[model samples]
Target: MDGQDEVSAREQHFHSQVRETTICFLLFAVLYVASYFIITRYKRKSDEHEDEDAVVNRISLFLSTFTLAVSAGAVLLLPLSIVSNEVLLSFPQSYYIQWLNGSLIHGLWNLASLFSNLCLFVLMPFAFFFLESEGFAGLKKILEDLDEQMYMITLEEEALQRRLNGLSPSVECDLLDLEQELQNVKTLKAKLERRRKASAWERNLVYPAVMVLLLFETAMSVLLVACNVLCLLVDETAMPQGSRGPGIGHASLSAFGFVGAALEIILIFYLMVSSVVGFYSLRFFGDFIPKKDDTTMTKIIGNCVSILVLSSALPVMSRTLGITRFDLLGDFGRFNWLGNFYIVLSYNLLFAIVTTLCLVRKFTSAVREELLKALGLRKLRLSSAPREPDSAKPSANGHQKAL
Candidate 1:
C-alpha cells in the first residue's frame, strides 16, 4: 500500500484500539462497583449474628463475593482485547510498515502495549486468589477464637451448675436467665467450630494452588515478552533493500523466520512444564498448617526461577537446531487433530487437578472436628480449672456471697 494509504489505515487502527480500551475500562469500573456492593451486603447480613463464628463467616462471604466480581471483570476484558486486535488491522499499510521498522518510538509503544495487556489478564486472578487466601486466614483466626470462647463458657457453666444445685429451690429460679444464656453460648460455639473446619480446608488447598498458577503465569509472561522482542529483531533484519530505513536491517528473511519459530517452540515447552509443576505442587501440599504465614521470600524465589528457566531456554531453542516456522508447522501437521486435542486436554487436566485438590481439602476438613473429638481433644473451657474451695469464709449472712 502507498504511504498515504498506510497512514490513513494506521489512524483508523489507533482509533479502534482506543475505543476498545475505553470499553474495557468501563466494564472494569462496573464490576468493581458490583463487587463492593456484594461484599457490603454480606457484611451487613453477617453482623446480625452475635456469635464469633458468624463474624468469621461474614468475612469469608465478603471475600468470596469480591473474588467473583474480579473474575467476571477479567473475563469481560478478554473479549475486548480480541476486538482490539481486529481494530489494529484497519491501519494503513505505510503506517504499519513504519511502525514495524523498529524505531525506538515504535519499540517503546509495543512494549507498553504488551505489558498493559498482560496486566489485564493477570490482575483479576491475583485479586481472586488474594481475597480467597485472606478470607481463609481470617476464618482460621475466628475459629480459634471461638474455640477459646466456648471453653471459657463451658467452664463457667459447670461452676454455675454446681452453685445452682447447692442453692435452695427459690434461689434457683432467680438464676434461670443466666443458665439459658450460657446454654446459647455453648450451642453457638459448636456451630462455629464446624464452620471453621470447613473454611480452613478451602483456604489450605486454594491458596497453594493459586500460588503455583501465579508462578506459572509469571513465567509465561516473561516468555511472551521475549517472543515480542525476537519478533521485532526478525522484522528489522528481514526488511527489503528499498524499504530499509535507518533502524532496519537487510538480514536473510529465512533466518529471521527461523529464529521466530524457535522462540515460539521454546515458549510452548515452558508452558507445558509450568502446567505440570503447578498441578503437582497443589496435589502434594494441599494441607493447611496451623501457623501458616504468607511466605514472601518463597514467592520471590518462585518468580525468579520461572523467569530464569523460561528465559534460558529461549536462546538454546532459537540458536541450536535452527528450526523454522515451516519445520514447526510440519511437525504439528503430522499429529493433525491430536495437536488441538492435546491443547484442550491439557487445560482440562489442569482444571481437574485444581478441583480435586479443593474437594479433598474440603472433605478432610469436614471430618476434622469429629476426628479431634474421637482423639479426646474435644473443646474445653479456658477458665474451667476448679476454684480453690472458699479460701475465704462464706459471708455470715446468706444474702452476701464470699469474695
Candidate 2:
C-alpha cells in the first residue's frame, strides 16, 4: 500500500510541475502576442511624420524610454548575471555565504529573464529603422551619381558620332578631342559599374542582418507558445488515478496549438529563403528601373516588399518568443552556453559585422575589388592598348633576318 501511495504521490507531483510550467509558458505566449501588437501597431506610429526637433508624443516617448531602459538594464545585468552564477560567486565554507550565493543566482536569473524579454520589443523595430536609415543616404548618392554618368555617356556618344561624320580636315583636327570624349565615357562607365557593385554588396549585408534578427525573435515566440500548449495537455494526462480524464475541448486546444506552431516554423523558414531571393533580385534588376522617372517608386516598392515580408512573420513570432534566459554554469541543471552564445551572436556580434562590412564595401574601392575577387566574381577590366607589329617579335630565322 505504501509503495502504491508513493507512486500516486509521484504522479501527482509530476502533474503539478507540468501545470506550473504550462502556466508560465502561457503567460509568456500572451506577452509575446501582446508585444507584437504593441510594437507593430503603436511603435511604428511613433516614427510617422514627427520632426527631428518636435516634442515627442506621449505614446512614442513612453515606448522609446521603455525600450531604452530595457536595453540598458539588459546590458547592466549581464555582468551581475555572470558574477552571481554559483561557480563564480563562490565563497569560503559558510552557511550564510552559501545561502547568499543561491539567492543571488535566483535573483539574477529572474532579472536577466525579465530584461531579456523586454529587449525583444525593441530589437525588431530597431533593426528595421537602423538598417534603412544607415544605408539609404549613401545608397541614394551612389544611385544619383550612376544616373548622371548614364546621361553623360549619351551626350558623349552623340558628340563622338558628329566628330566622325565631319569633313576630313575638320574631323582630323578634332580626332584627339573625340578620343578624349571616348575615354571620358569609358571612365564614367567604370565609375557607374563600381558604384552599382558597391550598392549590391551593401544590400547583401544589410538584408541578412535584418532578416536574421526578425526570424530569431519570431521563432522564439512560437516555440514558447507550442511548449505551453503541450505542457497543459500533458498536465491533464498526468492527473492522479481517481481524477477524471481531460475533456475533448482540452484535446482540441492541444491539436490547434501544435498545428499553429508547426505552421509558424514553416512560415519563418519561407521568409528567410524569400529574403535571400529578394535581395539578389533587387541587386540584379534594380538598374533596370528607369533612372529618370521611376526610381522613387522602385525604392518605395522595395521598402514595401521588405516590410511585408517582415510583418507577415510577426503573428507567429508573437505567439512563440519573448524573453531569453540562459544558465551558463549548469546552476539550473543544464549548461545553456549555446543559448547565451546565440543571444550575444544574434543581438550584438552579427549586427556589428554586417553593418561594418556594408559600410566598408560602400566606401572603399580597393576593398571592394578584393572582396569581389575573393568571391570569384569577375569585374570589368579596361581594354589594353594594341601590341606593336610582330616585327618586334623574334624573327622566324633570327640568325640572319633583315629588319
Name the lDDT value of residue 98 in candidate 2. Answer: 40
**Cα lDDT of all candidates, in order?**
0.42, 0.43
**TM-score for each predicted model, relative to the true structure:** 0.25, 0.22
- Model 1 lDDT tens row, 1-403: 6999999999978876665466445655676578656445323332333355455444444434434443443232212222222233333354543323223223323333343334335533454355445555456666876999999999999888988788445557758977999999999999999999978775666545554554454444444444434443455332111122322222322333434433444444444455436543665433311112332222322332333333333222222112222111112123333234334234334544554465456547545555444444566524577665674546677544645
For model 2, residues 1-403, the per-residue Cα lDDT tens digits are: 9999999999976875565456445544554455444434423331323332122233333343344333333333323333333223234455554433433434444544454444444543553354455444445556666899999999999888876887235666579888999999999999999999988876667544554555454455444434433433455332111113231112222234445434444444543454445555686755533232223322323333344334333322222221212222212223233234334234333433553454445447765555455444535555487766655676667754457
User: Stretches of candidate 1 above 4 Å error?
Assistant: 1-18, 33-155, 162-164, 168-403
For model 2, the superposed segments whose C-alpha errors exceed 4 Å read 1-71, 74-102, 105-195, 203-217, 236-403
Highest TM-score: which candidate? 1
